[model samples]
Target: MKQTDFVEVKQMQVKCVLCDQIEDIDDDALQAKRLRNRKLNMYLCTPCNERIAKNTKKRHKSGNFHLFKEKKDTNDYL
Candidate 1:
């Protein structure tokens, strides 16, 4: 008997968390920031880069945060 290595990837299928316009993404840029040795990937559309700024503002003002949880999807782009 042989054992095979299984790789599980979780993806989110929501409209780009940044733009909130593009229902989907083509070739977007993913940047990873390190926090406590954990890397967090941030997804954004070229035009919607400003959304990140806006998000920061909301976090600063209301102390509220929105996170995009990963779901299982085959259309994930690395």
Candidate 2:
């Protein structure tokens, strides 16, 4: 096998879970590596991620969005 064959095989085709858009990413890229290693981090195309971020910001401006954060226990330091 030639080096080109390895390169071609290393290229990964991923689909965005939100928009179903297909994108080719280098297997050695950090995003590709994360996707391959982690099950929870699903792929999202640039557009979908941007749209979601925009909506989240709009919700925040409405003053009704609440983020539940875990309260740190001060007793843990004892």
Give the winner by TM-score.
Answer: 2
The best candidate in terms of lDDT: 2
TM-score per model over all chains? 0.25, 0.56
Question: In candidate 2, where is summed lDDT lowest over 10 consecutive residues?
Answer: 65-74
Residue 27, model 1: Cα distance from true site in angstroms: 13
Model 1 agreement with the true structure over 1-78: per-residue lDDT tens digits: 334445434333434565565433322313322211246444455557676778778786664322322322323642
* Cα lDDT, all candidates: 0.45, 0.78
Candidate 2: which stretches are off by over 4 Å?
1-9, 60-78
lDDT of 2 by residue, 2-27 (tens): 98766654778889998899999888
True-structure lDDT of candidate 1: 0.45
